[model samples]
Target: MGVRWILAAGLWLAGCATSPPPSGLPDSLDVSSRHELTEVPFFPQRDYQCGPASLAMTLAWSGLKVTPEDLKPQVYSAKREGSLPPDMIAAARRRGRIAYPVTSTADLLREVAAGHPVIVLQRLESFWQTQWHYAVVIGYDLERREIVLHSGAEERLAMALDAFEQTWKPWGYWGLVTMDPRRLPASAEPKKYVKAVLGLERTQRWQEAEQAYSSALARWPHHLTAWIGLGNSRYALGNLAGAEQAFRSAVRAKPDSGIPYNNLAHVLMEMNRTEEALAVIRQAIRLGGPQISVYKKTLAEIQRRRNS
Candidate 1:
């Protein structure tokens, strides 16, 4: 299979010293978000009907390929705010598929009201754990006024839509999916693994993050994000050799992406490979990496170091 190369975005290190702890770890390790949950709806449901994996599977089965870049929280938020067209929905429905992307519980209710099968993604907190979980809303019972969903392991359950919405809205009422099995992916396993890795990385659990990323690579070796995360963690841990290999793999995977180029240049500079670093940074600039000023500043510094 051809490698898919994507440029890595510049690492945003604001307040790096105070970065929050990783999510999805044991509660003892969690750092408080300080942000209150004001928007998410809380509902009592026996099961959750739809989730990230299910949505990914449904899309794949429908012949739609969703990349990690496409599912960024920002992208979903944009879709919810009506900034993007519902192309996914229109595309699937054209093939006699039934699915919709819903930004709010109101949207899901509208679909339910129309007697159409709906798949919803909702932000949820497990009552028992108080941990955030993304769930899929699969079906609803009008008589009981309960929204049905597919919880991670619960398979399926129902809850009052209003209560569920109230609890979930705070996390972002972003949800979308297809109703037919034909719309599911050939395998939801890859997407599931990818998410698990990201969850670990975001929470800054380096060891677990590394293991999760490694596991993802075992499944999808060419996964660019996995390589990027692996490279990043290695770099953070001062394993320059390992970091270099991971970044190189990322570049090989997505040659078109400037992110790996920029990152590779940074690593090369750390190793005092000035000439090579200059060349790679130039490539990154050519490929549209950001912070041109910083790059120029680095070039000056490199020249100074060489002259000295």
Candidate 2:
């Protein structure tokens, strides 16, 4: 190639390599705030094992002494080539921690400032040749506009949040954090955590599910789903009294909804309170919730038990 042609190509590549990252941090973020959770252990990822490495870091901080190698089968996807969010969440729940996605940059920063290391995905290459990366965020210096991450082989990778946004923003600025059941996110809606607990119930992991639900209730006593879910966990564990109280709380939270009454009726029958069961079932039927037939069957069963 000609000397001038080579020089032109080199300059073009240099500009691409030094391209400035995107900008736009949330206005509500405290730019002067500086915080770091140094307690989270760093796990340097090997090869394309960022998923396992990041998961190990967060899980370890949440009180599990697990390693990346121990999580490969659960969080590592050999078929798709990398772990997805759902897999990461399931792995954390399996270990008895409440893990959920952070919905915004502010929420992520909130978690970090609160001493929780957050695992986030960042884009590592050109737009046309995108490379996905997972990194654990252990700290942030909002005054400097930098976010500290446990990225790749680096222990404390300080990245500009705006620049980090370029790499981390879409994928919905995807970030996940695993925390004790009693701890809740500062800026996140109560429903976010409640939904996470419900997700656990769906998978039949009701063991620690009650802890999360109770935690949710402690934070927002008016949360209907928390009450209902707590009832569900109690019922699953054969605690009829606790189940009944939860359902009653659910009933108080949303008087217009008949679901809690129906649930409470079933628990009453389980307790051999036949007359009370029939009365509650009748109230649920009067409200005409979605499950009419189910309520009718419950009422019939109570009557049959009472007749004999």
Candidate 3:
């Protein structure tokens, strides 16, 4: 992130991806041609602190009071030259918010329209000197064909959408936003949120995972993965009853899914409901079609518990 003195001014694009942008913006965005999230706060990047600065601003806007100085150790990599996207996303999850990728311009715009600012990676250099930098997109003007960003020392930096897309292309147009788990991305599928939260839990952040899943359930009541995730988190936290309820909800949400049956059976065995456990284990064995070994292990475990 040697982006301190690298003024991205007058940088002409030598190469831009030929892929087209998103088809259409969301209808809810009252795009009378121009829009700006004036209330979105900003923090200018100090040297290679763009990653931290951008995250601090976006997270603060999402309901956290964090400064870039506070986030350096968590996101900045002195050895790697800069912070990676995964690290930034992980840091957001560690801070108890869902940090999911933005796939398209429409997605970025939708976030702005929904009052969320997006952190985007861009090439702030000429084609000959590619400087990878992080910036926060705060607004856009479709009629003027431009987007606004909080980049470097400049707040409210504006660039033609074409130039923005070009600069973003080198980085695969990568961007992300932090938001309440109860809120879903406007231009994305509900499943994306599940993956992001589950990814956090996979990193061993169970409390955050539990909250994320709860939010998912509140927003999309039938999100089977969320119920399963909530149950797993509860189980890990030693809440057998809560885990049992979540697993039961999963079964009700998606009766065909084999995972809930196996998990529910295990929880019942843990609660010393051996007879009920045995009943569910059989159902798990039958429904857990592909992951035969999983339910088989659960069956053996339950039998061993009863014998003990």
Candidate 4:
């Protein structure tokens, strides 16, 4: 079926406007400082692949206990595109999970006001100038209407949900993932703590970024990005051994990504491992490295230096 028809059918099946307020709680609790647990009890060892069915199955397998079939009965049969159905939300609530198919920043703020946790899946522009999908949401509030969210890379704080929602709408709104305060995983709690660290790295907030990267590494040892960032930061800070170790770990964790290969090659060259560096550069070329031209130029320079 066509995408629009599928979406319409999903809206109809979900009983869109007819969804009742989530069960088991009144909508009047103060959202700010609501005191939910601050850690994820069971983060998946592998990164969950994107796609509606894949996500549904992963959440189910991760202990939410609801299958794609369960969600299927509530929404359109042909893979509803865009925001999640209200019926799906109701089912999640019944199972003690909070659900919101946020369309705007305002929608996010409203959900936060209702004393329910929020999850937001957004399409964002990546460094490669292509759009990529990411998921985060308001996990808590240390101050009124200033919320915290479980953003990829780290937790984020002091955001006005409405502002955040609106700010992010240029990207598509996929859905939200949430749970009750009591049911939230301890390891996953305080999402802002992690987000803050990643944010600093993005902004070149070097000192703070280093500390944040360290903390996240302590918690999620195999996180590939963290290792890469840690290595890069250490290299910048002149800690060669630390940087080398970090880059090695990153390459081991994700051998296919060309960025780490390129980075490692540069470091190897600096350490006088010219042959090893050339081998790494050749591997990156085979793997479709982003800096193809730069790689070519660097390889030529390396050959000239060796001849000299």
User: How many clashes in each structure?
Assistant: 37, 1, 0, 20
lDDT of each: 0.49, 0.76, 0.77, 0.48
Per-residue C-alpha lDDT of model 3 across residues 151-227, encoded as one tens digit per residue: 87889989999888877776567889887665665554668878888776767777777887887788789988888
User: For candidate 2, lDDT tens digit of each residue in 1-308?
Assistant: 11000000010000011113343457676533999887899888776678889989999998888998999898776666677677788888888788878756777777887778888877678766656788898888877878898887888988877878887765667788887776775555776788777766767677688888888888789988888889888888878899899989989998887778878887887788988888888998899855777778767777877898
Clashing pairs in 2: 31-143
* Tens-place lDDT digits, model 4, residues 1-308: 01000000033221111001111223554334533324322121112222233235324533565544455444333343223434444444444333324454444444555533444444344355433333334344535544465443343444554455443554344455443312322224234334434444444445545655666677778777777777777766767778778778878978986666766776777677889878887887788755676666666655655576
Find the candidate with the highest lDDT and give its number: 3
Q: Model 3 off-target regions past 4 Å?
A: 1-32
Best by TM-score: 2
lDDT of 4 at 266: 67
Q: What is the lDDT of residue 45 in candidate 1?
A: 25
Which has the better lDDT: candidate 2, or candidate 4?
A: 2
- Global fold similarity of model 1 (TM-score): 0.40
Structural similarity to truth (TM-score) of each candidate: 0.40, 0.87, 0.85, 0.40
Candidate 4 is scored at a TM of 0.40
Error in Å for residue 21 of model 3: 7.4
lDDT, candidate 1, 226-270, per-residue tens:
788778767767788888898899889888766776667777777
User: Can you tell me which runs of candidate 1 are displaced by over 4 Å?
Assistant: 1-196, 289-301, 304-308
**lDDT of model 1 at residue 16?**
6
